[model samples]
Target: MPAPELAAVPGSQDPAPAETGTSRPTATSTGAPGGDAPLGFTGAGTGEVSSGSPDAAAVEEPAAPAEEAPPSTQDSPVGSEPAEGAPATREEVPTAAPTAPAATPAEPTATPAEPAGSAATTSEAAAPAESTAPADSAAPTDRAEPTDGAPSSEAAAPGEAAAPGEAAAASEAAAPTDGAAPTESPTPTPGPRPAPSPSPRPRPTPRRQVPTPAAVAPAAAAPSVVAPVDAHDAAEAAAWGRVDDDGTVYVREATGERVVGQYTGADTEEALGFYVRRFLDIQAQLALFEARLAQITPKEIDQTLATLTEALAEPAVVGNVDGLRERLEKLRSAAGERRKQAAAEREAARAQAVAERTVIVEKAEQIAEQDPARTQWKQSGQRLRDLLDEWKTAQRTGPRLDRPTEDKLWKRFSHARTAFDRHRRQYFSELDATQDQVKAAKEKLIARAESLSTSTEWGRTAATYRELMDEWKAAGRASRKDDDALWARFRAAQQKFFDARSAQNAEIDAEYGENLKAKLALLEQAEAILPVTDIKAAKAALRPIQDKWDEAGKVPRADVQRVEGRMRAVEQAVRDAEQAAWKRSNPETKARAEGAAAQLESAIAQLEEDLAKARNGGDAKQIADAEAALEARRTWLDQVQRAVHE
Candidate 1:
């Protein structure tokens, strides 16, 4: 059976070559396919054009047709070249263009069948549709142009030639054309077609991996056919590509057809369908990219945009690439805004980092500025180190700061740390010197305290020790380990001496305990001498008591004040009584009293004489005066008499 002829596209001056319907697109990035593999979209759009895949070549021995006309009634597409003087109604006609190699029927030969697939395409060749080809389809490399000796005109006339062994008897793809509307041809009715039975065969290269075809479709005259394809997909794919009888595949774009790749193991529909899927994959990639716009950085977006733009510049898949390019342009515009946002975010982060580093520096400065004498060097030093660590961490991981700003902050921080360290060193140095002086002073004080500790003069020794303790207190301190050891030694010396003193004092107190008791007994006896009412008796009793008190000897140091105080009280009482007695018996005082009494008596006698005369003369005033005088004289006389006798 001979391959069928293809109808011409509606707009093209020439007819189309072998091709089939393309599949509709149903995949998208918004609603992705149900798998991790992004390119293999399985949706309504996955339906292949026409009869699934491109037409594969059917090989046979070259045999010249004796009939003048072939059975094919359809018009010639790109590579139509019939046998010499062959019938115009032939089922299969060689679609070789005028520039194609003219056939030499005189000498026939055989060419091994090359792997090929159906050229699935669309009938509306004016505008391209989304392709359903596999994602790895090659770039458009259509061989239908005149530059390749395959002119973009009607298929070769009845006498035109195709490639060697490629006869018009069963050659040419039944692809739709842009030259005219598609008309029904002698093809398999649009229905379910049997799946192609594949037979593995050796291949030279691993270009496009598709199994070799061993069987043909129900249409014996058609070069090849694939599994059932959608009519709509077939119409779209017609605008994108076509297949040659030798199983060569090409994708059609605005820049014209460029040969993409070849997989001659299948029919024209499968071959064009392969490129269509490639177009779909590109769409999916774009959708996924757009979806990821939020996650990627501005720089990454620019990089990816460049890559995508480069890819779209000369895309391999068959589809409406203009739309993809337009979408990419929109993405580029959005990327500019993203870049601005990223810049703002970076600025905010950088400012925050600067503030944090400043805080660390300020804290270090505070520590450095503290008074070395009062500063807690251990804790403050640790804190300073922690600040430094924080500063380093910010430098390594945080957003970069401007050079001047970073340098200034680093200088301040470094200076603060340096100052703090210097202060610490200086303080320890001074402390060492001061501690040495203090240790010497304390050593001398300890020696003094030890010297005084064992002295038998308990009072003087204790007072000296108290003075030593005061000097020790004023001596300040030494290093901790040295101070502790020195203090223990001093305390031991003081304790030993003091222990001996305490034992001696205890014996003395015991001996004096008896004296204290004896003094107390004598004090009671002297006091019993009734407050010196009888001065002589008091004097005699106190004399004996004083002698006894003296004989009692010294009391304990603690009881000395108390016992002596009580004994003195008794002696003082007795002395007071005796002094009163001596005052009463003094010769001058007695004579003064007697003389006073005598003067008063003489005055009374004179008054009595005046009174007697007044009485005899009956004078009331004189009698009253005389009576008062006599009374005073009598009182004076009694006192004088008593004084003289005492």
Candidate 2:
């Protein structure tokens, strides 16, 4: 009994009750009986106790009588003697407690106490040798714990440790003893069990040595005391159940398990909504990124570098990782080009503004430089006003300009306009005064011309009028009404003088009419002398006629030419007679006359000679007759003078 109890003690420091039996023999073969095995008293073997305990002889006493006849094959109690040449023994109890009673002697009354005691002693002596028999046998090494001496305190009750070895014994025991009472047995000595602390043990059973699926199935089907689960196990259990904070469950039928709900800071509904929103946001961002990538596809790497540079320049969030990276890459190439474009635009705008400002300043300066005294300045002033209006209108509608420049330009323009307006107004006012003076001067000149209109000295009055007219012209423009009235007055005065002088001349012409008739009668008497043949008589009569003509007054202005022509002819006859008488009386005059006649004859002869030469050359005969006539006249005059002298 002690040997079996001793074997019931677990050999290992903390032996699992379920694994104790299977591991015992091999553990014992390592040479230290019960040393290498689990120390649990739940499944101690008889041989193990005989080898481990010095008191095996005494402990085996009680089982000697019952097992005396089957000494060679019967299992021994705890605390038996060691056998020679036998394998070392383990302290694990067998799991054959239900079969133990059948292996015991059937008739306990028929057996003598001395023989039973001696049988127990002999069993103890043979325990070590019997323990090796199972190892040598070809049967499975794992066995059920013996009920005869199993430690009730160490091993689980019949329902516990329902592993294969123990379960088979239980089924066998249940078939015949269904209605029998479970016998009360002494509590076996306590043995060490595996650590009861739920902390994970580092040492694990080798996978190959672990129970096969078939072997573990029977154990799993049986009811047994389950070890308390650890936190990790509880988590795994929760995962299997698909339990979440929001109480949602998700099962996966294919896996025959539950899908764990993802851990979220909030409840299921809220978390789901958040995730949905996040997913949509991510999708939207991805779409935007794709669009941006397309826009920059020409130089993808450069575009990405540029984008990254831009992203780095600004504040950004962690969520913008992809965008930031792409942006920086884009910036690498695009930065210079963008800068150049921007700079060019800036410069162009600046130049345009400067050009506009220069035009404005130049216009204002031109206005300032204008001479206020000139009429052209007045036109310039008006033009400046127009320019100012244009400037103001442009300020309201033209291109954008810097405020300071606009203000400065406006100031210059306003100043120039103000000065011009003031000067123009002052000039016009002074000109009006000058015009008033000119108007007074013109009025005085008109009055002076009118005063001289009735003067009898015609030439002197006309000369004064002419001088006033000259003065009037020399005077500048007067007020429009005054100038017109003054000119009219001056013309009226000159008309009055001319009208009086014409009337006086008409009266004088009427007086000359009577004198004209007397002169005409005398002219008729003188014209009658033309038919008289006595030269002396005609000459004497012509002298009287000329005297009468001189004594007679002028003829009518219209008949003056007729009367004078008749008188001149009568006078010419008298002169011709006197000249003829002189010529006839003077020989020297006749001689000189003859001499001129001879020179004329000589000129005529020379002209005839030339004419004859021209006739041979087809010259005209008319030219020769003119030369002959001229010579004959000269001879006739010379002869008449000679006859008069003789």
Going through the candidates in the order shown, the clash numbers are 95, 66
lDDT, candidate 1, at 627: 90
Segments of candidate 2 deviating more than 4 angstroms: 1-340, 367-374, 399-412, 454-459, 492-646
lDDT of 2 by residue, 126-151 (tens): 21211211111011112332343433
Instruction: List all candidate RMSDs to the true structure.
Output: 17.6, 35.5
Report the C-alpha displacement of residue 387, candidate 1, in angstroms.
Answer: 1.4
lDDT of each: 0.52, 0.42
Task: Give the per-residue lDDT of model 1 (tens digit) for 1-646.
Answer: 1222211111111112222212112111111111212233122111122223334222211111112122232221211111111111122333222322222211111212111111111111111111111111111111222223333221111222122112212222222211111122222122222233252211111222211221212111243423343556445744577767644556666666765433332466655665565565566668878998877898788777775775565544456667778898898888887888889999999999999999999999999999998999999989988998899899999999999999999999999999999999999999999999999988887777777666778677777777777888889999999899889878887787789888988899998898888888887887798666888777877787888888999999898998888778878877887887898899999889878877877887888888899899898988898898788778878878887887
In model 1, which regions exceed 4 Å deviation? 1-269, 450-454, 519-551, 557-646
Error of 2 at 483 (Å): 2.5
What lDDT score is found at residue 119 in candidate 1?
17
TM-score of each: 0.50, 0.34
